[model samples]
Target: AGTVNPLLLFDEIDKLAYDVHGDPAAAMLEVLDSAQNNSFTDHFLELPYDLSQCLLMTTANDADRIPGPLRDRMELIEVPSYLFDEKMEIARRHLLPRQMEKNGLKRTNLRVDDRCLMRLIEGYTREAGVRQLERVLGSVCRKAACEVVEGRQRVQLSLARITEWLGPVKYRQEPAAAEERIGAVTGLAWTPVGGETLEIEVSAMPGKGHLQLTGQLGDVMQESARAALTYVRAHAAALGVEPDCFDKIDVHIHVPEGAVPKDGPSAGIAMMTALASALSGVPVRAGLAMTGEITLRGHVLPIGGLREKLLAAVRAGITTVLLPGKNRDSLHDVPQQVLDALRITFVNEARDVLEHALAQSPVQDGGAVLPDGEAGHAAVCH
Candidate 1:
């Protein structure tokens, strides 16, 4: 009791139980609050000592787990997780080289190249901090030491070798669906770890133009799609489409890999484009990728991960990429090789995107020159 004791330490206070029976933690508020503590009445122990004399401290692993009402009473401090570069720095400057010498193995006896380190971070470990990364590298060092003790003079591990030793890559891009259809767009999303390419698919059936969604999309994303559809319908006349196209078709939008939930309005533009292409008998320019949210006004708002998305598009063999005009500042960060190989189009409107994302008929061999908009459906945007 705060009235009887002078100090209190609450470990795992975040996990305290709460219900009609009683929340002991909530009952302890008066004793814990310094301002009102001196006037607190303790029914448990009939002592009248000042509760403010007690020093109270609480600890928790994840702050989110703490009840909001309780969390508000405490001062919160956050410790951010580390990145790969920070892990590499820690390993190179301290971890690996230290472990090698401690295990009595010379630097010449074993070496892990930068690529190998990257593999260890990307494939063997999934962590925001290097605690696990340090442990895995320790295991690798132990194995390398055993090899040196025998007859092996030197060893170097590559990305593939890391997988062989670690049993399999912990992370790999989910394979895009084998069948690339007219209404699907592969979008890259940036997370705290890195970029993940998300496959957004839109399918339509002969019914009223109702929007149906699946794949655990969040409210923001669902709203983004709604806004996107509204924008497309409003601009139907200008895009050379019928106003009743959506009214006549029942459309379903899905982001594959339902196990992982996704949110954010950034994918709105991409979703709109895919659905527009599907309903209008047009194909999204093969290899052309886009991101951004659209409103009823048809403005393409910028999204994050410009460089990472462009890189993902390039890896997917996409040559012509469409990006929000506001993200032009990020263009400088893209590799020259990607820039040279791909045609990058930046636009502020959905119409600008539509103009470039459609397949233009390619000039047939030894035939008449094709017109600007006559490009036949070639999925190869590159």
Candidate 2:
């Protein structure tokens, strides 16, 4: 251990603790520092130890929980959650064989179709990782093992058999194929579990220019709604809305699934699109999804979790995705099959979002209008 370099892995570094006694994170800072670790001394050893040659690797679900100085010392590589197809491949190639062996079931005795595996993924498990999926497969294998012992020679698992083995479905997917309407737009969200679809709904009614927000939104999301409304008001003339529309109307922005608390700046463009659609009396295009932060000046800003968000969009039957121009570089992370199945457009401004999301052209003074091509341009498609 003297001169030979050793690799050390610290798993779940976010769970590191601190108390009145001492801060472990602070101690880790010194160990991780290349400049100081060369002569680092252990309290118990009372002797200097050279840690400069040591390679340190850490894993954490949320990097934000790690101390800023310690986090700054390491290069962050984000590993996104697996997509549906990737999960299926992993299950088929790895989990099914492993679980079958553990349950004492011969490979020839049981068969699970690909469609059935997909059903299990969509209905029984809702997580970012495959741990839940492995457990569910283990459960199915255990049941099949029992059936074999009870004199059933061959067992075939299908979608219908999932409920019999795993009880009622635990998760319900809101129909993505439902009809599209005005004042509602789909936004992609990234959570600790994975990417999810967020539906933002906006409605205007007669009032004294009040903006009401609901659905347990956090501060940043509320601010996003405000920025979106402000942008719309500033561009009312261009959008073909009455200049004083808000003076006699109240605007309400609501995200569905109200029980789950929602926050983040990434929903800005979605909220803006919803407001624009509602105010302009145009319906949002069906099967279209988007995610991006928006500035008061209507410029779109990049957000995180592009790959995960695009996967969520695809799962929800979305055929087109609008992304910020800055995020175009990350398109390589998405699978080529997914990219081929969808129309991905990159935009630098809110006007670009409007052009793709609106079902009909914006109306001004009772006549249809087009966005100024000179104002901004679209990024090349992926």
Candidate 3:
């Protein structure tokens, strides 16, 4: 059996232990190497074996925790979290039927409609996978079975019924309502579970020329805020912001939900919009959300998780999204319903982001407007 080719599975390989006993991951390297495993030897058997034909597969919750050399030896395939619609389909087609049989309930006796399932998903469960959803469905089926045993012939589940059974809603669909105001902008963020709308708020006060960043932001996000401020400062004259504004006042940028640590470059455009709005006293357009990185030269850089972000934007009732021009190619991955629900603008430069994000021109204060001919010049500089 040792010599026979067998499939091997290593679960939670990232948690493989290392100690004085020796490293399992280090030992696995030899066994996993196709070119070397043909004559692999086991210490216990004291015999040479052929394991070259053996298939190896591994799973991990976080790939970054895997040892670098071990990770480099295998092909990496990232499985993104399931979307809302996907979860609804899975529940109707698979989970409901399976739970009905397991709970000794007839399919005809217990019926769950799409609306009920959607309610369960939105209010009862918040997860990237369907394990919790399956459990919830099973709970519903068990309750239905009990009712049937008590002489209730049939049970139909709806949102109201789901709420009664589930006790209370576990999660809020949207964290906060979208408000139109100066110095506050909505941003799209991606998490391990799903996408969420993040609000970046900027406020200016009388103090030394310093930028204060809060909300447990990581270094990368802090740098993004600095870059955003610099861009706004460099184009202050064009944006109709007073040149000495930053020199005389301190700016504070904060992302809500301070308990959760956030680090990424995708909030660059949002930060820029917030800062510009705060300085120019112009409100950002209501229900507009955006995500992208920005360069010092005011070019918008592409970021990942576009699909999840867009879905989040739609869920938050955002009517418009501003994304990098380079990300236009990835729009095909987004559902057509989401595309149709939101007006998406692809922008190449920071000016374009401002043009769409701000409700009115920042240059409304009688500032010198760039000539039509200079539009091409600004684009060239970008």
Model 1: per-residue Cα lDDT at residue 327: 89
Candidate 1 residue runs with Cα over 4 Å from true position: 1-95, 99-104, 125-135, 146-161, 174-181, 304-321, 327-344, 360-382
Give the alpha carbon lDDT tens digit for every residue of 263-376 in model 3: 999999999988877777667888889999999998999999888899888877889899999999999888888899899999888888887777766333333233232332
Candidate 2 local lDDT, 149-222, one digit each (tens):
99998999977788888988887766564666878999999887888999899888777889999999999999
Clash count of each predicted structure: 4, 0, 0
Which regions of candidate 2 fall more than 4 Å away from where they truly are?
1-3, 19-21, 39-49, 175-178, 362-382
Error of 2 at 226 (Å): 0.5
For model 3, what is the alpha-carbon lDDT of residue 290? 93
Per-candidate local distance difference test: 0.69, 0.85, 0.82
Cα RMSDs, all models: 8.4, 6.0, 5.7
State model 1's lDDT.
0.69
Cα error, residue 306 of model 2, in Å, equals 1.5
Segments in model 3 whose C-alpha atoms lie over 4 Å from true places? 1-3, 12-24, 39-49, 149-151, 175-179, 362-382
Overall local distance difference test of candidate 2? 0.85
Q: What is candidate 1's lDDT per residue for 126-158, written digit by digit as tens?
A: 655576777788778878888888889998866
